[model samples]
Target: MTGKPKLYYFDGRGKMESIRWLFAAAGIEFEEEFLETREQYEKLLQDGDLLFQQVPMVEIDGMKMVQSRAILSYIAGKHNLYGKDLKERALIDMYVEGTTDLMTLIIMYPFSSAEDKEKKRAVIIQKATNRYFPVYEKILKDHGQDFLVGNQFSWADVHLLEAILMVEEKKSDVLSEFPHLQAFKARISNIPTVKTFLEPGSQRKPVPDDKYVKTVKRVLQMSF
Candidate 1:
């Protein structure tokens, strides 16, 4: 594999930023391809591998990688960025999966009508607050530390912590209800590597809502 991979991303804040942060934290060298329009994005898609044909995909050693989480996992594993050991890796996976679930909801909200979006966001937040909070609390309690896993940092911590920041932008004090999670998010944010990555002008816009038909409201109905 090449020392530096080719990274495809958009220019606004969205799902891809976490991957960008992941690579930056790992100290990986990568060339970023930024697209600003449909034509440019489509042109690259035509040449991208057929499996997913998606951006935020990483091209490493001439191999086309797709799916955001998959790309994060691959990079984390390759760079020894997962965790300290098997147990820690498992914890990281748990946090990553939960964060993914939360992000998926956020991605769907912006595409719906304002009414539907408001309603959907409320439902998502309610469920997450009631059902998901305790689970995460237990995780923090189990770990007995600020990190989701071992002493060192991992992809999960970066992903969840960043997601919390994004969510809080739209929903104030979302993590306040869960003190452990609140502390956890703050702890990850304080890391020098993560702190730098979270700084301004580093994120790519999320996949456009117009591109995906069946608006956010539709997804919310099915999701919640």
Candidate 2:
């Protein structure tokens, strides 16, 4: 924690943005090493630098680490973004897992063929915007809390909020039906560090392929 933390990931936000958000939110200094090509990432995999052979690896406390959620939780716990107690942590973990499931469905849209992508995209969009979103909506409604865990913001909320923003970029209206999540996202997006991370100057990755976006938009249409 004395020196700057180092993060390894692609320029995109696929699975690493919440880590970035955690660093930014904690006002922690970190260095980013973006893997620009599949070849570079493969080299690291072959070298065994990554335990999981993945892009989102991190070096903190002089030790390398993998798994996005673990890193997020670690950073959150360090920075007090995690819940204050064991019960709160349990609730936070539940919401975090739900967000991960939601992320899994959306991330799969790009892995299929352009034709297949659209077909699968419709189903994913239905689940994300309709099926998946409402689950959180009901939870948020029942909890009647500002965040997923308690009154204060938690890392789980950060993860879920970032996932929501990722979807909103492709199909902006996806959250139209979920007023609770809408309010939740708005609240988290206003955090000082998050606000800075979202600024135009902080965005390093270009808009990725529109094929995925188009597929996502099509999915939002729910036409299949």
Candidate 3:
């Protein structure tokens, strides 16, 4: 019998959720540990005696891996989820990197005030929407592929879909303005694997509660 995968994650809408969705879509049985507070995470670390100093670590048959993107790529390769060919795989990686860059900016907007965030959002739009969008639009147009890769689903598509959702949530109608990206997101979201993984009741959005936000706010206040 094969050993199950063990995954550690925080409760929030972030990188870890993407990996969780992948595992769920792949029909892989594994342990998911969701920590909502620093105290809970510390206790879990003590109890498990884990080696890593971060959440979203994965232990595959006792071999531990960290870094969300690295974990996603590793599992994608192992599970044949990187599309049909080497070129397709490269394209998948390309989009994954692109999405990561955008998401990094999007997440920061929420922790900041509206004035600062609006300025940042404008810059992101000028660079990401104008420059990056064209690059992605050309890729989707040339690839003639439903997914970011060849004719199949890949981690890249999932990451891109997540990025699109986040951008929408942050009040950017970049997708509507760019039809190709909109198409890409819609196509990826409808994948049989993705659909099954996202089935109702399988998982819940893990946005942090007000108390957790307040704690972080207090800590930042002290630091600054």
- Clashing residue pairs for model 3: none
The residue-by-residue lDDT of candidate 3 on 1-224, one tens digit each, is: 25888776644555576777677666676676655456765665776644565556788856677778788888888888887778878878887888788877765555656568688878667767776667778878887777667667778777777767766665657676778888887777677767766568666354444554455445224241
Per model, how many backbone clashes are there? 2, 0, 0
Model 2 per-residue lDDT tens digits across residues 168-215: 765788898899999988888888877787788774344456543454
lDDT of candidate 3 at residue 99, scale 0 to 100: 74
TM for every model, in the order presented, reads 0.79, 0.82, 0.79
Least lDDT summed over 10 consecutive residues: which range in candidate 1?
Answer: 213-222
Task: State model 2's lDDT.
Answer: 0.74
Candidate 1, residues 130-219, lDDT tens digits: the string is 766667788888869766677667787777776676677667877777888888877877787666666775443344455433332232
Task: lDDT for model 1, please.
Answer: 0.69
On the 0 to 100 scale, the lDDT of residue 107 in model 3 is: 52
- Those runs of model 3 whose alpha carbons end farther than 4 Å from true positions after fitting are 1-4, 37-40, 43-52, 84-86, 197-199, 204-224
Please give the CA lDDT of all the candidate structures: 0.69, 0.74, 0.69
Q: For each candidate in turn, give its C-alpha RMSD to the true structure in angstroms.
A: 4.9, 6.1, 3.5
Decreasing lDDT order of the candidates: 2, 1, 3
For TM-score, candidate 2 versus 3, the one ahead is 2
Instruction: Itemize residue pairs with steric clashes in candidate 2.
Output: none
